[model samples]
Target chain A: MATQIRELIGNHKILPVSMERVRDEDDLYELGMTSFASVQLMLALEEAFDIEFPERMLNRKTFASISAIDRSVSELVSGRA
Target chain B: MNVAVNPAALTTPALERMARVADEVAARYAADVDATGRFPEETFAALKRERLLGCWIPKEYGGEGLSLTEICGLVARLGQACGSSAMIYGMHQIKMSSLIQHSVGSPWHLDYMREAARDQLLLGSATTEGGIGGDLRNSICAVEVVGDRYRLTKQATCISYGRAADAILATCRRNPDAASSDQVMVVCRKGDYTLRETVDWDTMGMRGTRSEGFELVSEGDARQVFVQPFSEIAAQSMLAMAHIIWTATWYGIAADTVVKAQAFVKAEAKKKPGTVPPGALRLAEVSASLQQMKSLLVAGIARYEEALADESLMNTLSFIAELNTIKVSASQLGIAIAQQSLMILGLAGYRNAGPWTIARNYRDLLSAAIMINNDRILGNTSNLLLISKIDVSVA
Candidate 1:
C-alpha cells in the first residue's frame, strides 16, 4: 500500500513529499497534497486497486491520509457483499 | 473491459484534484470576483502550484500528459468555481495544444512548451478580429515576412486575459491573394506587442473574464510562427477535446446550481414548509438535467478519446459535428437548469451576496453557446445529417 501510494505520487509529479513522512492521521494538505491533488491520488488509487470509489466517499475525511485511504479502500473492497 | 488505456490519456486524477481546488476558490471569492470583475488571480495561483495548469501539456514537455477528456473535466470543475478563470484556462490549453500539434523541428517552440509545463507562461488566442464582425472575416491582421522576421498588426476582440496574458497566439494572413493559403497562427511574446485598452467588457455574464479588445503590431523572427496553415489533424483532435472540456464546465455549473439550490431549499423548507415545495421540485429537475449532462459529457469524451487514438477517425466530421450537438444540448439544458434554480432561489440569488453559485454560473455558462462558431457547429451538424440521409454511402 505504501509503495502504491509512492508510485501514484510520483506519477502525478507531486514531489518532495514521501510516504514515510505521511502520518496516519496527518492532514494530506500539510503533506503538500492540495485538495485537487488528493482527488487525483484517490483516482489513481481507484485505478491501481480496480475499485470504484463511491461518490459518498468524496470527502476530505476519507482521503486525509495514507491510512485513511487504505482503511476506506479496505472497507469498500470488503463491502462487496 | 480491460482495454489497456493509455495512462497519458486519462486525467481522472487531475480532474479530481482540480475539482476540489475549484470548490474552495468558489466558496471563497466567487461573489467578490463576479461583483468586482476582478481576475481570479488567487485561483490561478492555486492552479499553478497544483500543476493543474500543466494538465494537458504532454509528459515529454513536463505536463501531466492528460487526455482531452481529463482536461475538459478539470476545466468544468474550474468553471463551476469561477467561470472567467475556467474560460481563460481553456483558451490557454487550446493555444498550447495547437502549438504542440504543429511546430515541427523547432527548438524554440519546444523550449516554450517546456517552460509552459513548469512555471511556463500564460497564453491567449487573438483570433476574433474586431472589424471583421464574425468568424468568416478573413483576418485583417497581415503578417509580412522580412528575411528571418515577420511583422504583424491586427485587432483582437473577446481576448481572455488580454491585459495580463504573457503571450498572445496571434493569427494572421501572409498571402495577399484570397486564394492563397497563408493563414497562420503565430506565438508572439508580450515584449513585442502593445495591448490597446479599449476593452468594453460590460456584459450580463462572465464579467470576471476581463475579456476585452486589444491590438498587436509586433515584429518576430520566423521561428515565432508556431503553426502554418494553422490547421492539423491534432489541432482538429484538440478542438474535439476543447468541445468536451466546455461540455464538462457547463455540467459542473449545472451540478453546482442544483447543489446550492437543494441546500437552500432544504434549509428553508424546515422554516417555511409550504414555499419550499417548488424549490425542491426545481432542485429535482436541475438534478435530472445535471445527471443527463454528465452522462453525455462522459460518453462524448470517451468517443473523442477513442477517435484521438485512431488516426483514421479524423475524417469523421459528421461524428464530430454530432458531438457539437451534444455540447449545444448540454449547454442549453445547463443554462435552463441554472435559470430555474436561480428563480427558485429567488431574491437571495440575485443579491450580491447570494449563497447560490447559480447567480454567477447562470451568466458564465451562457458563453458556451456564443463562443466562436458555436451556432455554425449546430448548422454544420444539421447540414451533415441532412446530407447523410440523402447520400447513404457517406461515412
Candidate 2:
C-alpha cells in the first residue's frame, strides 16, 4: 500500500509533502492533489490493485490519505471493490 | 443468419432498413476495410439503401425527419462496426443536418438537399490546416461570396475520407469583403476541389482512417452558403453529436476488449498449476472497468436524450460539463481496457485474426479522443464549470 501510494503521489506530481508524513486519514487534497490529479490517482489505484473503485469512492475523502486509499483498495480486493 | 444475434440491429432499428443490413455486414467488413484503409463500399451502399443518410435532413426536404437521439444511436452503432465508415458517415450527417437547418430561402439549397437524400453522395469535413492549429470556429480558410456564388480556397489538413467522399464540407472564414460565419460549413463537390495528399499517417491507432491533408480550390458555383452562423451552431452541434454518436462505438470496442481479455485470462487460468493465473488479475480489472464504462455511457445517454427533448437542458452547465467528462472518461477507459487486453493476451492481441482484421481497429480506436474539438470540449467545459460553480454530475 505504501509503495502504491508513493507511485501514485509521484505520478500525480504531488510535492512538498514528505512520504513519511503521509498519514492514513490525511487529506490528499491538502497535500496538493488537484481534482485532475485525483482522477489520475484513482485510475492508478484501480490499475495497481486490479479492482473497480465505485462512483461512491470518487469523493475526495476516500483518497484523503494513504490509509483511506489502502482501505478502499482492500474493500475492492475483498469483494467490495 | 443469426437474426437475433445482435438484437440492437433489430430492436433499435436505424431510421432505415439498410442501416441494419450494414450493421450485419459491418463485423465482417470492418476487418478488411481497416486493413486496407479502404472505405466499406458495402456498408455505404447499405446506408444509402436504407435512407439512413436522410435521417438528419428535414422531412419537408426529402429526409426521414428523425430526432438527434435516433441519429446518434444509429451512427454510434455504425462507428462500432467500422471506424472509417463511421467517420465518413458522420461528416456527411453533420453537413446534411447543418445545411438543412441553416440553408433557408437560398435558391439552390433545396436542390442540394434533394440530391443529398436521394443520390447517396457522401460529405467530408476539412478544417484542420497543417501550420494552424485546428480551431474550426476561427478558421483562416477564405471564401469570397458574391451574390449567388462563393469562391473558396483552403489548405485543409488531414481530411478523413477525403478520397472517398462525394463532396467535401470545407469550413472557411468569409473574406473581409464578404459576410462570413468565421467558420461556415460549405458543400463542395469532388470535381470542385483538389486533393494533394500531405502526409501518410502511419500511426499506432485509428490507422485505417486515411486522414491525410489536402488542398481545396473551388472557383465556380462550388458551394451553397448555409443560412445559420456556423460558429455558434456548428460547434455546439458537433460537440453534441461527437459526445452522443460515438458512445455506442466506444461501448462496443470496450465490450469487445473485456470479452477477449476474459477469454484469454480464463484460458490462462485453466493451464495454471493451482494458483491465481497470471492473467486473472488483469482480466478482472478490465471487466470492472467495462462495467463502470457501461454505466457511465448509459447515464450519459440518458442525459443526452433529455437534452435532445428540451434544448434548454443544454443551458444547464452541468449537462455540458458531464458530456465532455463522459467522453474523456470513456476514451481513457477504452484505451486502458485495450492496453490491458493486449497485455493479457500478449502475442495474440497483437496479431491480426486474418490479413486485415483487428490489427487496424486497435490502431484506429486510439485516434477517437484526439480528433478536432476534443481539446476544445474539455476547455469549454472547464470554463463553464468555473463560471457556474456547479460540479459535473456523471451519474
Candidate 3:
C-alpha cells in the first residue's frame, strides 16, 4: 500500500519536486502538493483501493503525507472487511 | 389569469414577476446600455425591487428559495431582453448558490445571505487572476492574516460590474504559506475594498456587462472565508451552476433571434399574397436547431436538480464529467443557432439598425465558448473519461 501511494505521488505532475527526495514522512503540501493536486491524488487513491473518503476524512491532515494516506486507507479497508 | 401551479413548485409568481421586469427594465435599457458599454443599472434596480436577486437563498434566509429550473427560466427570459444583465445576474446567482450549498450551516454565510436578501446586494466575482494562465482553481494572490482579520490584494483579470457591485467574492491562497492552489473564497463588501483599474471593458458584445480588470485590496473578518474546501465547492456547485445558468442565458439569445427571424419571415410573406418567402425555409431549419438547444439545456438542468437532491452523487467522477460535457455541447449549440439565424435573416440581420438585426445576439453568443474556453473543458473531459466507471451510453 505504501509503495502504491508513493508511486501515485511520484507520477502526479502537480508535485513538481523529484520523488527520490520525498520521504514517507515528508509533508506533501511542503513538497509542493497543491489542493487541486491533492484532490486529484485522492481520486486516484480511491480508484486504486475502491474506497471512498468520507466527508470527515476530507481535510489537509488526511493527505498530509503518503504515510498518512496509507494509514487512512488501511483503516477504512480493515473496517469494511 | 388562473395559471396552473405545481404543488411541489414555488416559482410561478416569481417567474411571472421576472418576465414583467425583463420587459420593463431589461428591454427598455438594453440598447443604450449596450451602446455605452455600461452596467445595466435599471435592470438591476428592477431585480432588486422585485427581490429576485436573492431568489436562490433559502426561505429561512428570507428568500423565495426557487428551484434551479426556475432560476434558469428567469435568466433565460432576462437574456432575451438583455444579455449583459442576464450574465451579471447569472454570475451573482452562481456565487449565492455556492454559498448556500457549501456554507449553509455557517452562521456568517447564513447572515450574509439574509443581509443580501434584505439589501438586494449585487455580488461580484474575482476568481480569474492575472498571470495565472486563465486557471480559476489557482491564485497568484495570497491572503495575509493579522490576528483575527485577513487582508488580500489580487490583480483580478476581470470583475464584471466591479465598481457598482455591493460586495466582491475574491479567491486567494488559503494562507500566506499555503500552496498556490490552496485557496479560500472571501466576501469583501464595498467599503472594505478599494479597486484600481488594470484593464478596460471595451468588447465586441455583451458590452453592458462592463467587465473590467482591477487591482483589488481588501480586508475583512477571518470568518468571512468559506469553511469548505475550494475544490469541493467548485466540483459540487460552482462549475455546475455556472455552466447551467450561462447555457440558459445563451439559449435565451438563440431563442429570441429565432423569434425575430420568424417575424421577419411572416412580414416578407405578407408582401406576396400566397407564396412562402425563401427565408421561411431557413427560419424553419434554425427553429429546429433552437428546439434541440432547449432540449439539451433542459436535460442538463434536470441532471443538476437530481444532484442537488442527492449530495453524494455530486462528488462522483462521472457526474462532473457529465456536467463538463453539457457545457461543451451547450456552448457549441448556442453559436450554431445564432449563426443559422443570421443566415436566415441575411441582409436584415447583417444591418445593425433593422428589426431583424441579430448582430448583438451573434456577438454575445460567441463569448460562450471563449469565456471558459471549450478546449479546456474537453481536455478535462478526456481525462475523466478514462477513469469514470459509469457507462454514459446507457441513458
Candidate 4:
C-alpha cells in the first residue's frame, strides 16, 4: 500500500523532488505539493484504492504527508470491508 | 440543504435604494470619472451616506445582512452607470465574503466585521503582487513574525483606490521561509499600512478604478491573520465570489447596452409610423444573446448559493469548471453585446456626445475578457476537465 501510494504521488507529479529522495514524514506542502496537485493526488488515490473520501477529509491535513495519506486510504479501504 | 440565505431576499427594499443611488450619483459622474482617470469619489460618498458600504455584514453585526444575490443586483446597476464604481463595490464585497465565510474561530475578524458595519470601512485587495504573474495563489513576500506582531512588504500590482480605502486585505507567505504556495490573508487597517505608488493606472477604461500599483508596507497584530490556509480560502470563497460578483457587474454592462440598442430601434420605428425599422431584427438578435448571458449568470449564482453549506462542494472540479465558465462566457457576451449595440446605432453610438453614445461601454466591456484574462481561466478549466467528469444534468 505504501509503495502504491508513492507510485501514485510520483505519477501525479505532486512533488518537486523525486519520491526516492522524499521521506514519508516530510510535509508534502513544504516539499512543493500545491493545492492543485493535491486534488489530483486525491483522485488518483481514490481510483487506486477504490474508495471515496468523505467531504470532511478534503483538507490540508488529510494530504499533508505520505504517512498521513497512507493512513487516510487505509481507513477508507478498511471501512469498505 | 443550505438555504440560510433565502434567494427570495434578493429583491429587498435595500436593493431599490441602492439602484436609486446608482442612477442619481454614479451615472451622473460616469463620464468625468472616465475622462479624468480618477476614483468616483462622489458616487462612493453617496453610497457611504446611505450606509451601503458595509450593508452585507450580517444583521448580528448591525448591518442589513444583504445576500450575495442582492449585492449582485446592486453591482449590476452600478455597472450600468459606472464600471469603475461597480468594480470597487464588487471587489470590496468579494473581500467581505472571504472574511465572513472563512473566519475560522477568530473573534477578531467578527469584531472587525461589526466595526466595518458601524464605521463603514471600505476594504481594499492586494492579492496580485509584482511577481506571481497573475496567480493570486502564489506570494513571494512573507510575513515576518516578531513577538506578537507580524509585518510584510509586498509589491502589489494594483490596489483599487488603495490610498482611500479604510482597510486592505493582503495575502503573503505564511512565514519568511514558507514556500510561495503556503499563504495567509492578513487584514491591515488603514493606519497599519502605507501604499507608495510604484506604477500609474492610465488606461482606456475602468480608468475611474485607479487600480494603481504600490509598494505596500504593513504590520499588525498576528491575530489579524486568517486561520485557514489561503488555498482553502481560494477554493471555497474567493473563487466563487470573485467570479460570480465580477460577472454580475459585467452582465450589467452588457444589459445596459441592450437597453440602448432597443431605444435606438424604437426611435427609428416611431419616425416611420406603421413601418418597422431595419434595426428591429438586429435588436431581436442581440436580445437573445443577453438572455443567454443572463441564463449563464443565473446558473452560476444558483450553484454558488446551493454550495454554501458544503466547503467541499465549492472546491469540487465540477463547481470550479462551471464558475469559470460563467466568467469566460459573460466576458465575451459583454463585448459582443456592446459591438452589436454599436452596429445598431452606427456613428451615433461611436460618438461620445449623444445619449446613444456607447463608446465608454465598448471600451469598458473590452476590459472584461482581458481583466483576469479569459485565456487563463479557460486554461485552468481545461486542466480540471482532464481529471473529472463534465457532469451536466438539468434534473
Off by over 4 Å in 4: A10-12, A17-31, A39-81, B1-12
Local lDDT at A59 for model 1? 49
Residue B113 lDDT in candidate 3: 86
Among these predicted structures, which one has the highest DockQ? 4
lDDT of 1 by residue, B229-326 (tens): 54342235445656766777677767777777888889888888566566777777777877888888887877766656764454344445557677
Ordered list by lDDT, greatest first: 4, 3, 1, 2
Number of the candidate with higher TM-score, 1 or 4: 4
Q: What is the fnat score of candidate 1?
A: 0.00
Q: Which residue runs of candidate 3 sit more than 4 Å off their true CA positions?
A: A11-14, A17-81, B1-12
DockQ of 1: 0.01
Candidate 4: residue B19 Cα off by (Å): 1.8
- The i-RMS of candidate 4 is 3.9
What share of the reference contacts survives in each candidate?
0.00, 0.00, 0.05, 0.16
Each model's C-alpha lDDT? 0.68, 0.65, 0.83, 0.84
Q: Rank the candidates by TM-score, best first.
A: 4, 3, 1, 2
**lDDT value, residue A6 of candidate 1:** 62
Evaluated with TM-score, which candidate comes out highest? Answer: 4
Summarize candidate 3's per-residue lDDT along B1-395 as a digit string, tens digits.
11222333334488887887788889888888888899998788778877788878889988888888899999999999888999999999998888788776679988998988777788899999999856888888988888889899999989989998989998888888776767778988889999999999999998988889999999989888888867667877898898898999999888889988888889889999799998888988998888888887888888888877877567565677778888888889988988888887888898876677888888888899987899988877776555455444645
Q: How does candidate 1 fare on TM-score?
A: 0.73
Which one wins by DockQ: 1 or 4? 4
Ten consecutive residues with minimal summed lDDT in candidate 2 chain B? B1-10
